[model samples]
Target: MEIGTLQWYPGHMVKARKMVLENLKLVDVAVELLDARIPMSSRNPEIDLILANKLRAIVLNKSDLADKSQTEKWRRFFSTEQGYPCIVLESQLGKGVNNLIAAVQELAKDILEKLAAKGRKPRPVRLMMVGIPNVGKSSLINRLAGKGSTRTGDRPGVTKGKQWIRVGKGLEMLDTPGILWPKFEDPEVGFKLAVTGAIKDEIINIEQVTLKLIHILSMKFPEALKNRYKLEVLEEDPSETLKKIGVKRGCLISGGNVDTLKTAVIVLNEFRAGKIGRFTLDELS
Candidate 1:
């Protein structure tokens, strides 16, 4: 299986990092949103390290699109092995949001307690939500606030600025624009993001990404492609499988030839949107 590669970080990402750093002092904790399908790949390691001293909670957004059992495995893995509190959430349906306030309060309990002990009026736990582009940051904020409080679109770089959303009695959230690292050191991480729709398709080759996705699915979840597209699994040439999907889906040319490029887009879109089924591109062994 091949991982997708990404090149180029837009100007907005650079600006977002600075903005987040400038406002870091205002927040008590950080809620990092990650796509459940590719948790490791979707994370910005540099930003995480920079915010290391702050109380952090990982919200595995888009949990509905990922395998439920695997999601639980990841939750346990983060909590037990990594010592980070992790929650699996579905922003679209508003699932697992009620626990967000409680989780944040628990993670920042020490800070809150220390303030209370000093007879200082305990301030609301300030939380900053951060993540890479298109990782459901806005959607999660909207879900947490119980309304469409933030502008959300399918494309990346949609949340341009910062906004504070009050979640509960003593909790507030600062929504930050999505940020990507300066450069993707590991090409696999870039590819996973591209395959999962975190990266803009215009900057990437959809056909190439789709082929790589097919290769990964062929090994990790072979039945996913077979069941979703009803195409025969091929061990030798994966392009043949993509062509078969194109033929089945009627993505064809005027002369009745398979349009592999069109088929690639359909497959990639379906997989990213969960039409293919609940799946995770990466797994912990």
Candidate 2:
């Protein structure tokens, strides 16, 4: 529970990963969504192997909840350096959704051109939306399709199977269930994923994860943490900061002890809601 070793590869995730690999053959392009707040952590490295030779576009989902400056930098980093077209979008709010469509089309331009050269009619582009859980894949689909096309909740594993949903203007999307790698070798990666709600809260001890989140905030976003919690002094220790926050938010037990569980839940939920502030957990450099 103390950020030791965290492994959460449910049976369904393995099945989902397998489904993605197998279904890759049917898709014309791969659309991988990463949490704008923790872009690197949310990316599954296995995707490169799974999507070999397939044209891919990276969407930094939930961009509204992340630092806009950092999100732009990340977009450029992927587009200019990695050579993968990247779009920063808030799927729920519908910001930059149109840009995502354009990006996808651009990625498949050559294929579309080839089809035209052969005197064949242009076909609807097929894309498999891929990413770890809770990175707004379902939200993106709902936004694009303009309805509750897929069942969506804040929790993971909502979309259990791959679903084909048609969007306007020559686009058909295959919405796949979010899946994590079998093992999270780096505890930090696990911590980041857990803190960002990509990993289910049931799988991790929330108090421990909250402590790590607080530690990160204290280091990377001290001013935002200070202003949100309204603390006069930023404590060197994350536990101290958490305790202060617990006291301020009145998350206390019967004996005046800090109700860590309640405090952790509040911190995590608020962070995810962007109440504290827009933050980019993954660094560009």
Candidate 3:
């Protein structure tokens, strides 16, 4: 399957956009969550337009799975260059939760002061969490709320509707369904999204995506492939390398042939799980 042929935009995403726009009036700030590994690809480009004029901050979730040095560069890029307050987060473990709250509150401090000056009662900062599917928005919300206030899954499009949940004092968040744009103009973006589990595996050709991943790792992180799969040598062909990995891991079918599908699944799962190595696919050149 050609990477360019992969295009995913369900009708629900259209509704998601409407939902976000309607709720924008209730939000003081818009927090955009991006996967730390594929920061560029994981971002919903339309978010900037939809959240325009609203105070915005970025949270780089799943930082533990991305290259540490590159993550730092991205942090500087978004916070310093892009002029959005950025926070590095490992949402699964609740790391950086406090920092996120502090940063957001600081961003809304002026608004809080304005209310005080007007003799109006102070209210918690209302935030709308937005991001592409499977970018860890729900996990971050759950971490902040200190419970499973929203349903979460490893797959994409898990959150179907919006829900408002109050975190501790001075913080309330509106959780919305993940939204991807109508189409990907760049094929590499689609491949990155698919490789990172932002797109559902059932809808895409996993074998092709895995081959692309192997080719990328072979060039950029050869040592990771060797170390994780115990491959002493990698073939020039990614397909051959995948077969070698299959043989090493014993993914064989009848007649002792490598089960390419199973092998692809394994490689993709391991890559997403960060078992291969910490990587940052969207390198800043």
Best by TM-score: 3
Identify the superior model by TM-score, candidate 1 or candidate 3: 3
For candidate 2, give the lDDT. Answer: 0.81
On the 0 to 100 scale, the lDDT of residue 90 in model 1 is: 87
How accurate locally, in lDDT, is each candidate? 0.78, 0.81, 0.84
Sort the candidates on TM-score, descending order. Answer: 3, 2, 1
Q: Model 3 lDDT vs. the true structure?
A: 0.84
| lDDT for each residue of candidate 3 in 1-285, tens digit (9 for 90 to 100) | 365355445666677778778777768888888999999888877767888889988999999999999999999999989999999999999999888988889999999999999999988787877888888888887788785343322323424354667777778787553354534678888888889988777778899999999999999899999999999989999999999999988999999999999999999999999999999999986
Q: Summarize candidate 1's per-residue lDDT along 1-285 as a digit string, tens digits.
A: 334344555676667777777667668888888889988888777865668688888889999899888788888988899888898998888888877778998999999899999999977787877788888777877777765333222323424354666665777777554354534667677788788887778878888888888887887788877888886655547788898888889999999889999999999999888987898766876
Which lDDT tens digits does candidate 2 get at residues 217-261? 888888889999899988888888899999999999999999878
Cα TM-score of candidate 3:
0.91
